[model samples]
Target: MAFSDLDFLEENFIHYAKENTQSNYANKDQVPTTPGQVKMMQELAKQVQDYGVKSRYNEKTAFAIGCLPANTAGVSPIGFFAHVDTVEYDDRFPIRPQVHRNYQGEKIILDEANGVFLDPAEFPDLRNLQGQTLISSDGKTVLGTDDKAGVVSLLAALKYLHEHPEIAHGDLYVAFGPDEEIGLGGQRFDPADFPGVEFAYTLDNGRPGDFEYETFNATAADLTIKGTVVHPGEAYGLMVNATTIMTEFLAALPADQVPEKSRGHDGFIMVTDAQSSVDRAHVGLIIRDFDWDKFLAKEDLVKNLVDRLGQKYGPDRFDLRLRRQYENIYNGVKDRPYVVNLALDSYKKAGLTPRVQTFRGGTDGNFITKKGIPTPNLFNGGGNYHGRYEYVTVEQMDKLTEVLVTIAAEHARQSQTGRDERPLKKYW
Candidate 1:
């Protein structure tokens, strides 16, 4: 049986993809960050009403929230979230989505002149998409499938439940938020909007059967070194070079614990950027780890490094500012296995093998989980995301639609009978 309306899926995905709703990190102080994001989210609010849900766009938070009331009793309210904004891309070029029907496992040329091709040899995942409808960009810009595929899949699932009301379900809440790529969307989300929502799933990145509850506990650090600048000809013991201090400070960090070397449940301290001069220098870095203790240890390492450097140099020469970005979702949901089990159970019912994995990065789920509603991540059904070679199959999106619908139906069924309370295993 077909899992979703392919025609609707393709039409909606294409329509939204061309709108240029990329989020801007520089404009993050604004609610939605960009006018394009607000425009698209505002349009989405009205569209969800057609699915028979009470929907509205919150101007304050820049979130379009819709609620499909429970058709069955005894089932707890649940939610699904998808970000409307795409990552920043080359603005000189337009994003025109190309659709290929019955993709026959061949090298697809994204831009003939530019020599941008999506090959199965480089991306072997394309081999699994033979005979499926593939969508891509024109090789000049990103296809915005990172979360637009997610947005459309959530819409398809809600529309499916609307068309077939006989399929019993509890209250279903759907949220389309802005600036998730920059990490401000969920941080600004007011859980009061999703009242009584016991749990949620973010339709973000992954393959068809991917379900992730474990993610990195993240924090960003800004280290600044102050030094006295003196002319080299007159310089003696009075000249203190901030660049030298910054270099020494960076060298003190664990080289082994970094993004290039860290994988699969391992933590890392990465220096994202650094600027140095004789007078002042600044270092920007991010810390990520799955284990809480190890995460703190990484943070402490930075503080201790700064302390040691400050003592070596003058105590007033160094300043370290560390702020938490988000925490791992598993910290909140470890005791509550029902949230993880429910989605995995629904995947099986939808004829998919559940693949629970650890996300080395953080998601909107991390912030939402901190708000007392445990949120995990589900798949968005795309590959090569956030770049020119990105691609998504309509069949993959159909599978995601089925998973969403099945999750709602199974949640109701288990509520009337019993919930799957089996303990979750560490999949990493």
Candidate 2:
């Protein structure tokens, strides 16, 4: 079953997505969900209610809402999460998002007048968005698909569930948070506010068909390689090229494991920061993999590389430090096999192959799982996140809503007495 009707969401969503002068701060798209976005979400909450799922503004900009089957047969309660804050980007101006006729499997030229283009070559993913009226920014601006797509999909799912109350489901918790891009989304989240099942699905992934049970074991590694400054002419053997030595340090780690070179289940070493001059140089790194043991091994290898390099160059020449930033989510959630396996089935029941994934970066799900809410990240039908070339398929958004509906129905069935089966309420 589908939403009773799409016009309500279509009309209000379009109106909500394109508001003006809302940019409160600098060029940062800072029109925070404060009073404005929260207002829109509150308006959305009025459309449906089961538990104030899209409830109201709390500490940081956040809103909650719940959708449930109107009948008694519906079982299980689960939360579906997505963020509302758009990332700080360039020129998100006067966006004239236009919809085409019935998506005839063709390319759309958003606005060719501004010397910008969205063609098939640069983004082959467009082929999958065919026959769907895709929403995007005009050529000169960056489309806010990093998460607006997710917001819309969740809203659409709620809209659909409300319209077709006959669909089988239990309590469905829905949330849209703020400041996620700023690393603070999880800071103010009250799992109690979205209380029900112990698990949730964050509809905020890179592409359709993406279901991630795990993410890289992430940590920030900083190493500073010091060198003495001497006159160029006197810089013979004594002059350790900090830049050259840095290159050797890079080479010390495995070459093929870089993010650009690695893929499915492949671990990698990423040097996110590198800067140098004749006098001094500093380098930073992040190690990643889906497996906890392998991830730890990688971090050890990096520490060993830096230690050996420090030994070769002496303590004066090399200073190193490592700390655990955010860790992988699999081990924490793996015990609750239903957390990942059920989601895969939800994806399939929605007619998409869930590509159980490993993130190249960390997400709120990584932290949420640790917070005792085995939340896994799911797709929002967008690609090229945090950039100008980003795009999300309306079809993908539709499918994602279906996935949300499926999970809610299944989760409630697995629970007892309308509460989470796992030991979260007390522990959390």
TM-score of each: 0.99, 0.80
lDDT of 1 by residue, 1-428 (tens): 56789999999999999999999999878888899988998899989889999999999999999999999888999999999998889888989999999999899888899789999999999999888999999899999898999999999999999999999999999999999999999999999999999999999999999999999999999998999999998889989999999999988899899999988889999999999999999999999999999999999999998998888998899888999999999999999999999999999999999989999887899999999999999999989988999989888899999999999999999998899999988786
Which predicted model would earn the best TM-score? Answer: 1
- Return the number of clashes found in candidate 1: 0
Model 2 accuracy (lDDT, Cα): 0.66
Q: What is the lDDT of residue 200 in candidate 2?
A: 82
Worst 10 residues of 1 by lDDT: 1-10
lDDT of 2 by residue, 233-274 (tens): 998877877887788888788988898998867878889999
> What lDDT score is found at residue 367 in candidate 1?
97
Off by over 4 Å in 1: none
Per-candidate RMSD vs. true structure? Answer: 0.9, 5.4
